[model samples]
Target: MFEDAFKLKIRPDGLEKAAARTYVTAVRDVLEKIHRTACGKALLQSIRFHGYVVNIIPYPGADVCGADVDGDYDAATGIVMPTVRYTPGNFAKGGSCSHLPGRGWAESILFHELVHALRDIAQGKRRVYKGVVMTGGLHRYDTFEEFIAVLCEDIYVSERGNPHRLLGDHRGIAPLDPALADSFRFFATGSQTFRFVERFCRENPGFTKMLSRVPARFNPIAAYYKDPRKAQSFSNSPAAHERDADGVWGKLFERERSPTLPTGSPANLPPPRPASTPIRRP
Candidate 1:
């Protein structure tokens, strides 16, 4: 492990020597894939690597191959990445996901978890976007956080391509319901990861909750928003994802009447949104 340059610790927990080695190697490969572009590097820098830990424990009953825990506020403390092969999900030892920039299942899953960690970072109290601080709010669950994370996972796959679900790429983008097609189309297809998130805040308006509603209210400084819902943080409830009158997601959710629809990019559609101003943390 000393020779590996990935900063975070990969705690094999109780795995034998060979299993532990595999986990360590997976760390190296994920870091390589994540550093392949400038946007990927932004994702890495947003979630600083110090004190981050990757645990090798299976989330069997949970049906997940990987997971992330909410940090005290600004960052997630660590991530759970199972070393055991998840064949049902087509994630196996040394197997690669059938997606763009195609890479190992471990890399794909870890990248997704890293997005979760990044979300926690973005929702921090002191993060001023445009001008005002992004405090006291939660981009909670299936509607908000997962929206960015999955879109991000696909964009990470596409690099610079529009992340709209393409033919045969069912694993990631395929699962979204029809109404979200436009949401994904509008957000993911336009910008790379960093701008996608920054614009999401601007476009969606109040998708993130009020700072007064969260723990950040008490100790505004040095405090970031945190999720207390445990594994259910992905829950997309009316409260957690209240549709704002002028918010983009609000408009997207209004089309709920459309039943299950297949994922496909139409020949004629809206062009990519103009590039937003550069985003920076204060």
Candidate 2:
């Protein structure tokens, strides 16, 4: 089912075709390994149950190495990824590859998006944390959602045996605060990983300060949820909802607690969507 859910295709150009095949093979190996892990199995089950398909397309000369359209989880539909042309040079410069060795950059980004897809289904439209809302929108790079996704990507990389590479990909998008960067490095390297996130947020004023600087346009819940009536309709109170979101994160961090896999067998899972036809751009 995991294999069927993720489909990769490239534009017909010779270079892109070769790159796509290489990336697809690498990504498949990573996903297969993930399927064997306790937390990964839960994520796969959630993605399958939600009927989410990940369609990846590799395009030449793209500015960003990879990007997904909005509404990835809206109504539980799948995600669309139009990736940048995969070249060793581009991968190295893309920032996601900084901490990864060889092809691990591709694997890390793929896993990062997979983490987003899993959280999209788990958190739904109304998830609110510490007054930051995610209703009717996606998470910004600086949000807790991204934090969790990055953390998951790091955990995956660590489990693959290069624990030192944790958050190398994230440094590009994360704030440039030396303290914050050091903190992430410490968390990635430390024994008490998840506990550090909880503690750091409490102890570090910089965390909230950096979050406050994120442009309002990047935050979906900022405008709509600010209205007292709208906020109340979503939850009893902001504090309560924040705690609920924390609980969800706690479960995601724990490998032993698996959300019951959606009912029915693999055959009942939805088939992969037809591949997107590539169009030649001048």
Clashing pairs in 2: none
Q: Give one clash count per candidate, in the order shown.
A: 1, 0
* Model 1 alpha-carbon drift over 4 Å, by segment: 1-7, 49-90, 93-105, 122-141, 160-282
lDDT against the true structure, per candidate, is: 0.36, 0.40
Clashing pairs in 1: 136-211
**Cα RMSD for candidates in order:** 14.7, 18.3
Report the C-alpha displacement of residue 211, candidate 2, in angstroms.
Answer: 26
**For model 1, what is the error of residue 162's alpha carbon versus the real structure, in angstroms, after optimal superposition?**
9.3
Report the poorest 10 consecutive residues by lDDT, candidate 2: 273-282
Q: Scored by Cα lDDT, where does model 2 land?
A: 0.40
Report model 2's TM-score to 2 decimal places.
0.42
State the lDDT of candidate 2 residue by residue for 92-146, as single tens digits: 4455334333345545565566665544543442242232322111111235555
In angstroms, the error of model 1 at 91 is 2.1
Residue 188 local lDDT, model 1: 22
Candidate 2: regions farther than 4 A off: 5-30, 36-39, 59-61, 64-103, 125-141, 173-282
